[model samples]
Target chain A: MAVLLALVVAVMLVGGGIFTLLAAVGVVRLPDVYTRMHAASKAGTVGSGLMLIAAGLHAFDFAILARAFAGFVFFILTAPVAAHLVAKAAHHAGYRLSRHATCDEMRDHTKK
Target chain B: MAAIVTGLIFAIVWAAVTGSLSPLNLVLGFLLGLFALWIIRRDFAGTRTVVRPWKLLSLLILFVKELALSAWRVAVLVASPKMDLKPGIFAFPLKVDRDIEITLLANMITLTPGTLSVDVSDDRRFLYVHALDCSDPTAVRRDIADGFERKILEALR
Candidate 1:
């Protein structure tokens, strides 16, 4: 059972690392601010969460588990808000969206 | 009542799981759990307000969009010829008043590529942010207010 648990933890860490790496790559390859934000926020948050969970499992202690879980929860709660603020700051600074962008929410906001 | 009970349970569980109920570890974990409860309680203080599910959903979507967009921008800037960057500091007036919300906003700005929150105004009225290549200032402010601020206000209000 311990071996199985170790295997599971290993897989989680590896998978999370790969996802985070992909997120970094997406940040490099994607076009424009909005799209990059999408990749970074989702990948960063979920990847970090999974990695922390794996770390908790590897430790196999309740205190460490609680700390890991708490950290994960904090990440989930904050990542989105941070992303939104960045985008909002960029938008407010008059950065132009790609022509491909279908909706212009900022324009609507200015009229108000 | 439940929070206190859960706090005690967390302390006891952590102590047993670690098998080292040393006075130090127990005291530390207990303090940590108490801190966690304080944060959680403060965040959920106003239960009487109606929740806005759509606002929450939109906030998530906006964050994802911004992350992808910022990363790409940074990559291009890194690859571009002459390494030309018009980096400048801009002050963004914040409408969100809550401490948790403002902290979240500041952290988000700092995490996004090509931008960082440098400082907050003493009065908490504006945020000072540095942009890597600031070609246009108005659009940046609009993005901050309309794109992020609006969603946060909706969800937290």
Candidate 2:
């Protein structure tokens, strides 16, 4: 049982670490604020959420696990809100899309 | 009726949060729940809609699936040696009008595959979404309208 629990923790930790690393890579590789927000909001959220769950499991206590779950829920619920606000602000501030962008419908709509 | 239900849910949550399921703990939780309800009742007034729990569960399942797929896709895109991304923002016409429904849809889109909701129009008629790949905006638009938007309508309305 102990071995299994340890294995689970190890897996969670490694998986979470890999995801967080990928998100960082995405932030650097992606061209602009909007695309980067995708990485920061989604991958970043899951990475941290997994680690939080792993921490809760390591304690092997029900209450701690529940609280950790609650934290994960709150984290996901708020991440997009923050990301949306930032993206909206960037757009309004005239931060242009990457040169590789295919099209921007929002820009067209605002023009009309 | 809604108030009682909300209070009960809150009480259960309180018990979980307090890390105890004892009878005393539950009663304390119930009282606290009622107190909380009293405080926030005005904010939620006149917004009670009948909730379909099963549909909501389905929505949750879909969200989980999309979340995993999104992470994998981002990881793959990020890891590839040659990045060929066409990122841009497009307007998604709003189908669900209620504040809660619109908010939920936006949040889900942000978490799902390659899509991040940037803003809502001043009139709330459209949602601006940025996609990591805008090579086929029509396909992406259809996917959201069919997938998340449809599911949200079923679950919430």
Which is the leading candidate under TM-score? 2
Q: Stretches of candidate 2 above 4 Å error?
A: none
TM-scores of the candidates in the order shown: 0.49, 0.96
Weakest 10 consecutive residues of candidate 1 chain A by summed lDDT: A100-109
lDDT of 2 by residue, B100-143 (tens): 99999999999999999998998999999999988888899899
- Give chain A TM for each model in order: 0.93, 0.97
lDDT of 2 by residue, A16-107 (tens): 99999999999998888888888888888999999999999999999888888888988999999999999999989889998999888888
Which consecutive 10 residues in model 2 chain B have the weakest lDDT in total? B1-10
lDDT of each: 0.69, 0.90
Best by lDDT: 2
Q: What share of the true interface contacts does candidate 2 keep?
A: 0.83
Instruction: Give the lDDT of residue B136 in candidate 2.
Output: 87
TM-score of chain B of each: 0.67, 0.93
Which segments of candidate 1 are over 4 A away from where they belong? Answer: B1-157
